[model samples]
Target: MLEVTGLHVAYGGIQAVRSITFHVNEGETVALIGANGAGKTTTLKAISRVVNAVGGDVHFCGEKIIGVAPHEIIRKGIALVPEGRGVFPRLSVLENLRMGAFVRDDKAGIAADIDRMYAYFPRLKERADQLAGTLSGGEQQMLAIGRALMSRPKMLLLDEPSMGLAPIMVQKIFEVIRNVAAAGMTILLIEQNAKLALESSQRAYVMESGEITLNGESAALLHDPKVKAAYLGE
Candidate 1:
């Protein structure tokens, strides 16, 4: 479970995220959907401590994690798959996955998780020894998600898993996400595709110009006139 209250983030003098509050329950997939510059990615970065929050609080599993170091955040059971699929381009697919488990020393468990990742992403298995940079965009995204899963995280922060991919590949990526959620992974997803995000998540938040503007059950948000007009392109 995760809770973020009155969160604020800034870069130098630019205020990026303002007073964003939301929660994701255990085994639930909560989505933050918005247009570019809406601060969805910044909010996730603040939650993961990749970028520090200037104000407010973040709690994970009942403890305040606002100031925790990024690596410590992982140790506490949260993993972030950032926007742009920040995979180690030079590393082999297998090696990239290995790096994901860097915070852990469970050799047997890590290896088993690698196998599980392969199951979730068969393309990765085929490219096990290949350089990650040489893979297609969609494959790289899959690798990013698989790498995050390697950490055996209690919750996943996914930022734009469908970005820059073809329609079929995006469908594949969302299918994997749905399967992961079905298997009880708690996910906080930041996505530009509002329809997909709302459809896949239990609850949703809409952000505009650095703040949360609307939030509710995803199904209800999907039909709201404003959401349909602005995000669903109706």
Candidate 2:
């Protein structure tokens, strides 16, 4: 449902992302896996319009979004759960979740969605009144994902959902991710955790030095020697 073609992004004379082309089919998860500085996050930023693309185009649901304003992105049915789990520190968990549906006016639907989020992450319901900044890393990650889903997005952009968390916590987060994907959420995941990314996604792309180095079925890439050596560490 999303297509990025010849995408290029440069900042401060450093090319963060080179011309890269990829697509995410509707209702499938596509992972972009790489190490630090691989331009994984930049590619998401460009697609989400958080950062400008110097060249190429981003089409979501067949409409160009490259020149679209950042605030307008949510209205187009795309939500980005950015890296580092950007949450409203000063706001309570409940307040933060309410903010997610800021673009909408349907109170009944928003209320129902809040209950749905609480069901998705029961911990969020427990910490309903707690300040977001005080939640643990995993909790904040859950909050981020829940908040994004409040918009009822057609596609979700996830950047490093596994970063800075305990192994058990990562497992918990991925469980939720699996649930979301199973329910037919279209996800374009950018992850430093290659193994998790591959296992979670249906198709995968290996990015290196700001370009796509390999692309194929996730299961095949899991067994590919080059992918194993460079990313899987096998």
Candidate 3:
């Protein structure tokens, strides 16, 4: 449902993402994995229109979205849960969730979706009135994913969902991701945890120094000697 072709993004004179191409099919989870400076995040930003692409096109549901405004992208059936779990620190958890549904006007549906999010992450319901900033890192990550789901997007873009969490917390987060994918959410996940990324996704791409170097079925990549050596530490 999402297609990125020959995407290029450069910061002044420095190129962060070269001409990279990949895609996520409907109801599929595709992972982009690589080292810290491999341009995985930049590729996501370009698709989300948070950063302008210097070349190539991004088509979502068959419409070109490379020119879509950052704010408007959310309305076009795409939601991004950024790397840092960008939550509204000053707002309470409930209020933060409310902000997520600002794009929609279905009061009853919005209320129901909020309840569903709470179900997805009961910790959020427990902190309904707590300030978002004060939550633990894991809680914030949960909040970020919940908030993004409020938009009811056809596709979810996740960036570094395991960046700073403990192992148990990561497990909890991926559990929800598995549930979401099972529920038919098309997800484009950028994860630093290569093992988890490959294991969670059905298909995968490996990036190095701003280019795609390898890609295949996630299960197949898991046993690839190069992938094992470079990403799995095996």
| lDDT against the true structure, each candidate | 0.95, 0.95, 0.95
- Candidate 1, residues 92-193: lDDT per residue as tens digits? 999999999998899999999999999999999999999999999999999999999999999999999999999999999999999999999999999999
Q: Judged by TM-score, which candidate is best?
A: 3
- Encode model 2's per-residue lDDT on 1-234: one tens digit a residue: 899999999997999999999999999999999989999999999998999999999999999989999999999999999999999999999999999999889999999999999988999999999999999999999999999999888999999999999999999889989999999999999999999999999999999999999999999999999999998889
**Which sections of candidate 3 miss by over 4 Å?**
none
What clash count goes with each model? Answer: 0, 0, 0
In model 2, residue pairs whose N, Cα or C atoms come closer than 3 Å (at least 3 residues apart or on different chains), thus clashing, are none
lDDT digits (tens) for residues 159-205 of candidate 3: 99998999999999999999999999999999989999999999999
Off by over 4 Å in 2: none
What local lDDT does model 3 show for residue 154? 97
